[model samples]
Each structure stands twice: as C-alpha cells, then as structure tokens.
Target: MDTKRIFRDFNHCKFLVFTCLLPAELFVSLYLDSVINWSLWLVLLPIWTLKVLVIAGALVGTIVWCHKPFRRNEADGFTDFKAMLITVGIQVLLLLFELLLCNKIESNSPISWILVFTPMYLVSTLSIGACIWGYKNARSTELESLISLNTLLFVFVSLKLHNVIHWNWSVIFIPLWIIMCLPTIVVLHHLWTLAFLRSNFHGVDKQSLVLDTIMWIAIDVPLLTFEILLASRLDQQNDISWVNIFIPLHISLLGLIWSTFGRKGGNTWWFGLREDFCTIFLRICPFMRLYGNVECKEREGGDGSEIMMMPVVTQVVCKSPSKCEPVVAVTHIATPD
Candidate 1:
C-alpha cells in the first residue's frame, strides 16, 4: 500500500472534514442518531492505531537522528541533526500531551489526563509566554512559538466549545469555524514549511510529506475525534444500525495513498492535491522558502543568508511646502530571498 499518498490526501481531507463534519455530524446525531452509534469505536480503531504507529515511527526517527554516528550522515553532519532533535522533542511532547488531555480516561485509557490537565495547560501557556518573550528580542521571528501559541489557543477554544456548544450551534457557527480555521491553517503551514525544509536539507527531488501526515493525523485526529464524539448521541435511544462515518473518511483517505509527494504533473495537482484550494489556504505557508531555499553546501565566500530585492510601491501624502497630488515612491526593499 502506498502510505505517502495517503498522507497527502489526508492533509487535504482535514479541511474537507473540518468544513463538513460539524454540520454533517450534527445532522447525523439529531435525525439519524441510530446510525451514529453503530459500533463506532470498532471502526475508528484502525485509523487511530495507524495514526499512533506514525508517531511511534517519528519518535524512532528522532532517536536515530540523535545518535552521533547517524548524525554524521546528514546534511550539516551534526548541527542540523542536533537542531532537528530539539524540534522533534518539542513537537512530539506537546502533541502527546494535547491528545492525553483531550481523551477522557474513563472512556478509554486507565490514566486520567484530568489530573494533569492543569499542568499541561500551564506548560502550553508558559511555553507560549516564554516564546513571546524570546520573539521580542530575537533577531529572527520564531515560527515554533507562534505556531504553538496558535495551537494552544485553538485547544482552549475547542474545550470551551465542547462544554458550551454541542449539536445545535448553527446560529454561532459562521464565526466559530472562521476563528478555528485560522489556527488550523497556521499549524498546517508549519508542517508544510517543515517538509520544505526537510526537502532542502536532505537534497531530495521531492519532499517527503510523511512527517506532516504523521503530525496531522497524530495531533489533529484525536483532538477532532474528541469533539466529534462529544457531539454524538451514543448513549441515547436508537433503532437502525448504519455504516460508520469513519469508514468513508478512512476509505477516501486510503484510496488516495500513493508513494509520491509534493507538487507533480503538468496540471496544478501538486502532490496529488487541488491547487486552487491549496493556494487559497497554503499561499502564506512559505517559511522555509521565505528567504529562498536553505543551501546545505557551503560556498567559498558566501554567507548563509540569501537577500531578495523586490520593488515595493507606496503612496505618500505631499508635504504642506509642496502641496500637490500624493507622491508615489517606488522603493526596492532588500529582504530575505
């Protein structure tokens, strides 16, 4: 089975599921409550387990990259590996903690995340606080801090929504999903940018989006699943049993699994995805490429930073001494290429 293509489809599927699921799930619960409850856990296990295995693999990769001998083979030999280790550590820890906090112990696992919720919340908030402090003085803006803060904020909003708004929240949903999508899109870009970085550092012809697939499924699936489960009428009375909602989502996800990754083809379906929608959402997702590509090979007298000059035209009001039409200044701003 082609796992990578599955990863790519799932990435797009997230937005699809996000857009439709709220209304779809709610509609299912209220009218077709019987179908909603029909052996749902039995069905979700496969994808849920698949998502966990993906994380386990990433953790394994983290350990391997951390090894001195393994690091020697990488692009920077040691420097890049060391930096990636820290990134992986932060990402993995926060992801697991968020999932743990989201899942109720009485429902599934024996360990009660409620006991640790306060601490986990404290850690997420404090990390964002520290990142904010670091961002103010740092020469470069930290993407990690901003992305993490966005996720943390979304989580807070998700939890609040779970408590207050269940099935019948159509009146406020227009603004709600808009607010929710902002963070989701930001995090999505973070993952996309990381894949771009990996492609540059590894010197691969195509970027391996598995890292993003893993991150999205592992982190987002659980978080979203919790909310979906919260809104369902599992315990309420029901009649007819129907097919699992996850089956179609998983099947649609599985059907798209191919080994290929990233933008491909003469058409716009880069990495086997719709270009128009991705452009609308992912146009701002260019962190690693913001300053052009990261070159692993060193040049004789070349500095690391790549400079890009773009002509920026701005309109300015004329001074009183020279009362005239607004002056247009076309200046070339030297920014990171």
Candidate 2:
C-alpha cells in the first residue's frame, strides 16, 4: 500500500541497474561468443558460462532485494517464493537440456562440469525460495531474520563438493551432503537471532537452535576444507600426507576466531573488526575501527545543526562484576526522521 516506502526500501533505480545489466551481458556473451548455439549453451563455455551464472546471481539478488515482502518487512515469507520456484524450474529444464547435450557429445563425458556448476546454479536459483515452513502462516523476512550471515560464504565453499565426488570417493558424499546442507544451519541461525531479538526465545529453543548452529559450523568448516584440499591434491597428482599441515593450521586460526567470537561478551561479537594495519596487532593504537564500526547510526536531523561524530564500535568492557551491560540490540539502529 505504501508505494514510497516499498520503492525506498528496495532502493529505487538500483534494481533497474542490475536488471539492465543482464541484457547487456547477454548481448556481449551471445554476439561476442560467436553466436548462440547449443555448443555454447549446453556445454560449459568456461568463463563465459560462469559469467552468465554470476549475472543470474545478480539478477536473483536484485529480485530478492526488491521483493515486496522484503521491502516492507512482511513476514509472509512467500514474497519471492513463486519467482524462485520458477527460476529453479527453469534450471531443471536446463539440466535436462544439458543431459541431452551430454549424450550427444560423448557417452562418459567428464562429469566435472556438471559437478562444478550445479551448486552455484542452485544458489543462483534456490535463493528466492522464501525458506518458509509453516511459521505463523506468513512472516516478513527481516522479522523472521531466518538467514545466517555465513550462508553465502558456506555455500560458496561447498561448491567444491563435486571435487570430492570426482575423486572417486563414494563414501565422501555422506559428509559432502552434510557440508552442503549447512546453509540450512545459517537460515536457522538467522531465525534464532530473530527469536532472541523478539524475546520469543526460551531456554529449550536457544540450546536446541543456537547450540546446533555453533556445533554444525564448528565441525563443518574444518571437515569440508580438509576434504576439498585433499581432493584438489589428488586431482593435481600430488601425494597427500596423513599429517596435513593445512588442517591443523586452519584449525588453529579458526580456534582463535571461536575463542574471540563464540564466547562473545565482547565488541567483536557485535560489530565486526575491520582489516586495519598495525592497530589489530597493537590494541592501544589510536582511532582503530572495523569497517562497519559506525554504521546505521541514529541521529536527530531536519534542524541541520547536529554535529554527528564518526560511529565506532566502542569496547563494552565490564570493569565491575555487578555492572554488566547488555549487548547492543537491533532496535538500536536508527529510523529515518
């Protein structure tokens, strides 16, 4: 009903920019790739095809951002459902077309291309599926907050699942399937944050959902990385050692991350750290800030006389036992005047 807010929330004109890019990219890929035929379309056309996937992702992202429910913070969760379903349906058709093309090419085509492109294809496809499951019938996405910040990162890495499969390790699919499924954990994490924010969370749910997320991610990263790396080595015809140096090194680094972020009665757990020089190494360094250190700050405007200071994620050090302050809440983000 509020068209202005909808456009504003979706960021007027931005969607057009991305949507416009698709045609331009298509023109270039089609015309420049020496015509559009089954050869280029059905087979993996290398970077050109990858670029198309990127474009598809961008287009999907654009649609997601502009979905009316997302713009209005509606909880129906059905906002982009139909669109995403159609997108996925189309991908399925393409997969069928690809299979036909495969048979046309060779009996035992190297399966690497199929493995490589499928996950991203799903990512660019299934992203708009609305992640709903009978929660109050309908809910706004932001309210539901049913997505983890780590979803994209984890999904991207899990794309390498095909690598493990290509290694001829049939048993690896079991773990591979689990790692790929971790995005659902991210969705649950988002939903968990929403419950915590809305005061809807109880002890049972917290331990069940939050603890589950922490455990799954804690296990997934190391396992997937080791598998992918081992597979890559095998692919490269290099000898793999039982004592994989990378596994321990990665574990140590992530262990440090968990210690800092997981226990999180700290600033880093709230506002993330920026990759600044020397300041991280020297804690006392003056004016050190993470990138979003001072983001979405609240302010009194219209009078145009306020002197707003640079927003920084200041440390909330609890110097006294009895004076513990609460972590910053999402409600703290300022609304427009």
> Superposing all C-alpha atoms, what RMSD in Å does each candidate have to the true structure?
19.8, 22.9
List TM-score per model, in order. 0.33, 0.23
Off by over 4 Å in 1: 1-55, 62-70, 77-149, 152-260, 263-337
lDDT of 1 at 205: 29
Q: Write model 1 residue lDDT over 148-232, tens digit each, in one string.
A: 5455444444444455434343323334344446547755776676656653456542334554455445444444443343334
For model 1, how big is the CA root-mean-square deviation? 19.8
TM-score, cand. 2: 0.23
Model 2 segments more than 4 A misplaced: 1-84, 87-94, 97-206, 234-337
